[model samples]
Target chain A: MSLAGTGPRRDGPARGRPRSEAVERAIVEGVMKLLEDGVPLAELSIERIARTAGVGKAAIYRRWTGKEQLFVDVMRAAEPPDPELPGTSMRDDLVVLLESLRLRGLAGRTSAILHNVRAQMKSSPRLWTAYHDTVIQPRRRVGLDVLRRGRDNGELRADVDLELLNDMVVGPVLVRTVLRPDAELPADLAERVVDTLLQGLRPS
Target chain B: MSLAGTGPRRDGPARGRPRSEAVERAIVEGVMKLLEDGVPLAELSIERIARTAGVGKAAIYRRWTGKEQLFVDVMRAAEPPDPELPGTSMRDDLVVLLESLRLRGLAGRTSAILHNVRAQMKSSPRLWTAYHDTVIQPRRRVGLDVLRRGRDNGELRADVDLELLNDMVVGPVLVRTVLRPDAELPADLAERVVDTLLQGLRPS
Candidate 1:
């Protein structure tokens, strides 16, 4: 999910001095810390971010446009590279991947970030798109690849729609995690969901 | 979905004169209109709501504690009574119920209201609880009844977990409707979801 190279390039190189990677890292780290601490997006100011990062305002603006871009950059940097699960059985692969999502949702910071971003999405479509493209799309591609393998291996019915199947497999976990954050997801949720889906896709 | 009499009892009868149903309806309608027009929840003030409803400020306060309560009341009032699907078959019943959810998501006002409430849930726990109790729980009970009938009639595996099955059948629609509001649900989505579930549930 790291979009380090994928994000919009900085507008030209720094005018007077070479860009400092340390400062950039500091800024990104600062943003992450603030978000994890439950700072509302509205209150996340460029000045405060700079202060938190121990960087000057000019240093912060040199690499990114504003808080939205900074936030995107921080998330992109923090996102772990997509896991390359070995070609195990589809059930095993899906369970591993979906369980990771479930666990991530349970993490306090990740959960807060997701909730905040979702709340701000309507107000900031561009930021939402950036987050979606950088974070969500890549993860979905991994799930899609797993399903495609199942189809090719004849584990799934030939006519099954991979896209719909992806949604079916992943959607419930997401709904339970986000909409009902207070409720505990079933301990065997990953196993149960995959079983139901695989049962549906098996040749009758 | 109507929770007219199911919500917490109003504190005693109206103290001064009788509560005006027309005024209450007007306030609810005003809330709906503002939300549909895309007014952010932060901007939806009681003063503005009063003006929009063409009722005195005192009229609203007399009934609802504030905007959140009013929102719950309005949604409860506006929500149509759950349809009785003649129990022709589990597939038919689920398709009807799920499609209704899809249609509700497509409706501008309904969609906006759902998003608004979801965004505010973290900040307003009590309102969220009211919504969950009055709106979400009753609908879930309806869905649970359908699944129960399916199990009893031998359309589903006897060992199937009805609660998990309910999430599987309904969760995808919710995820699509809420998370990916921009994407149109496939026209045959309800049929496809129900078909997949039934295929999985059949005692093989």
Candidate 2:
């Protein structure tokens, strides 16, 4: 795995300046294109990605250790970047986190590419674990941290289970996105989910 | 689609006793056996299922219209039956509905058969629609009816969106079951979720 801030390592013969950003974009987009066209992940190879990207296998190798690393990069490139928390309040931060989820769900509709790619990824244990570690866990940690802060600051009831709370807060958005694909994701979905949950279902 | 109550049609020459109960069980179990052994749903045919169940093709056709109808029955037979909602209270009824979902998630771990079979079903639009109509929609309708009754009886806030509330109440269970398969489904999960939501997150 490449270090986040250290930049791409220029190890192979292609080492002069850093790799062109255009080349990187092209490779990532090419993988996305193949996935969009219904190419199953199991069928994708470094050779095939290089062919589609119009680059040599060496070029792909220069950037990624292998298919798994490249796939992690592909998912990162595809998702909406992680939310920038406002530090204003827990409620505000949660809305930003959920809004990002809503956008990903909307974005996933393009060729339903993410949905297809994820399904294929889940079929292989190694690939799915890679994705869960790199892409899923960190984002989840962010949500948990926010909830922890909320509980400590007395914004949330101390007795509440943070893990369960995290699920309750995130679950509605996921239900719409993953399970109920036909359901509309209104623009105010994030706010509605947050406020409704905070206010409790019982009338005051 | 065989009508729920109208027993098997006895039009076929071989049918004298409305299809033996033992044979019906065998056919459904046979389909499940194939799925459990990792047979792709797309590859299953009536003849293949008949061969596995040790019944003739005629026996299957006499029972089901075709693959889609048979698949629906398979899903139905596999799922824990819909809860008999306790007419006690809205909260109690919601818990019953969610407990059923919890059981399903646990049941699904066996061979991960439901997860795999559902994934395959979604790939085929026609088949998925049949499933959505027969299995998914009815279950959703039951939840909605319970919510409606709750609102009417003043057990729920009058202004609540029943649809959204349904998703909110059901979402956590689905998250634990479907999204975060690693999460524990504790014995009191349904009660905990309901009470927490009713109490809200805001500190009293």
Candidate 3:
């Protein structure tokens, strides 16, 4: 757990990269531990994280620009790995993407980690913006790309607004995960959301 | 503005009702002013609010159960009045509901009032739950009722889960108002969301 001296050294290219990764992991894990322990984000100073991780402050600063950037990494580390889209069809790809979100919702650790961080981040504009730019927007872009491709391939209505469509498609997952945490996220949630949406809401 | 002596009195039945209403308005507006002035919720005490409103603490306690309940009234006082459903059709009613949300988004003061309150409320489960129970849940019930009515009238697919459908219908608005504040809430947003979902995302 003491990652002090294992940090990357300028002179030691032979093993520096692996040591650097270790230092990075230690720093990120240190943040996760603090959040999981109910430490308020406002009180989580870099010095505290460094002490907890047993690493030098320089080790953390070398990896991230600021607290916001560091928290982004903590979020990324705690998250389930992003789904690898099947690329076979837009519907299939969308299900995979949404399934990843559903899995994230099911993971107790991710929710625990986010519960405090998300609460504080909203009050801090800088932190909220950084999270949106780095974490949310990139994921949004992936969905948009899938939708755009689907439109081109005649799988989607060409006249549709992809941006709005993307929001609609992803809206339910976000609502359940963020707004109504108590709601059941059943195993077939991804399929239910996608299929229900595709079939439309109107009576035939 | 000095509502100290105007509070309801047991002996004065004829004038007591109006005086009580004035006292209530004074207390609610006082809280709004403090919040608008950037007072953190943690620092907002009943004593401080009474002092700010030129009313006795007994006056506030007589009306509200606690700080949580008082804040609920503050939210109510600050909000645009809830949309009156047209009851012409489910689609029209939904459009009116969402249009009200869009207007709330467009209103600078409502956003300003909610900005700090929403951020801090998330950290305080008691306050967040109070607001949800008092404000969010009531609005959600309205939407659910409409969806249920739609299903009964054969305007909605019988297979749809009303709870999830309600979320889907309101999800886009919440995203723009709460999550992505910068997203444009166009005038036609409600119609677009309803029509798009009704038509489905697939190619016709």
Candidate 4:
């Protein structure tokens, strides 16, 4: 909160040299810890983050414009690399992508932060846009690419909208996460979800 | 936020008879109004609800156990009745159901409350369970019945998991609502969603 003010000249650090990578990493790590601890967004202040990160408030201000900006950076940094799945078939690709998401995307701090973001997005549009652009869209692009490959290879029907197809394949995992945070996602969840979608997309 | 204390004897009201429907209506109305006006859940106190509803604190306490219970009642009251769509075919039934959900479920105060609940569920498991049981499950049952009918008619392949089938059809709308809150769901969205699912489930 209040990482930077909304002044007219709300650019990068007002008058300081760029901080080192070490300092930036510390700040991002601090944010991740707080989110994992299930700290409500309202209570996550810049001052507290500075203290936790062992950096000065001026250092945090020098790096990002505000809490939302900082959150975007943390999410981007924390995002796991796209899985290196073999392009064996559409079904195999989707299963690997989704299982990676469940194991890495929804694991530990990332899962906690995502839950917090879903809850807070409606109330904070600016933050939502930043998070979506920085974190969600990039990951989504990977999913889209997979579907596009399937369509191009004649593994999937050409007529279906790729965006809608993307949602169909991936949406259930997200919905399940939101509804039952404590429940274990079945080991076969990704396989089952993909099979259902692939059946819909198979060329006639 | 403190609707009721977590005391040992935290049963229903300690004394007095059940409140009248008029008083109950006022309180529920107050909760709806505040949610529509964008009051964050953390700031939504029972005292404020009492003031907005023009009812005494004792009146609210007399009926429900806490804010969570009152919220469940409001959601139950606000839910639109299931659409009486013609059971023309599986595709038609699904389109009508999804459209009704978009029009009624994601509109106005109900939409706002849903966004709030998604955010608050982690912090308030008891409230989440109450809301899901009272509001979400009943609507879900209607969707399940539609799938059951489709299977019985031999329109869909019998081997598909009915629960997963329901998620495949309905999950996209919920995901879209969360990701892009302001975007209009296309008129053809439901038809397209159903078509995709049905293709996968078509009898061999």
Among all windows of 10 consecutive residues in model 2 chain B, the one with the lowest summed lDDT is B1-10
**Which candidate, 2 or 3, has the higher lDDT?**
2
TM-score of 2: 0.88
lDDT of 3: 0.80
Question: Runs in model 1 with CA error above 4 Å?
Answer: A4-24, A36-39, A42-51, A55-67, A76-81, A108-123, A201-204, B1-27, B30-70, B77-81, B109-123, B201-204
Model 3, position A54, has a per-residue lDDT of 93
Q: Pick the candidate with the highest DockQ.
A: 2
lDDT of each: 0.73, 0.83, 0.80, 0.71
lDDT of candidate 1 at residue A61, scale 0 to 100: 70
True-structure lDDT of candidate 4: 0.71
lDDT (C-alpha) at residue B143 in model 3: 93
Worst lDDT run of 10 residues, candidate 1 chain B, spans: B1-10
Predicted candidate 3 versus true structure: per-residue lDDT over B79-124, tens digit per residue = 6789899999899999999899888777743577876676677778
DockQ of 4: 0.28
Docking class of 2: medium
Task: List candidate 2 segments past 4 Å from native.
Answer: A1-23, A33-40, A51-56, B1-20, B51-56, B111-116
lDDT by residue for model 4 (A1-204), tens: 112232112465444324456677888889888877888776889999999999999878876767778876665555565579788977788899888766753563356575565566536788777766765676788889988888888888778788888887777777666544554567888998898776663234
lDDT per residue for candidate 3 within A8-45, as digits (tens), equals 23443344667788877888889889888988888999
Considering only N, C-alpha and C atoms within 3 Å, which residue pairs clash in candidate 1? none
Worst window of 10 by summed lDDT in candidate 2 chain A = A1-10
- Chain A superposition TM-score, candidate 2: 0.87
Query: Model 4 off-target regions past 4 Å?
Result: A1-27, A30-69, A77-79, A104-124, A182-184, A201-204, B1-67, B109-125, B201-204
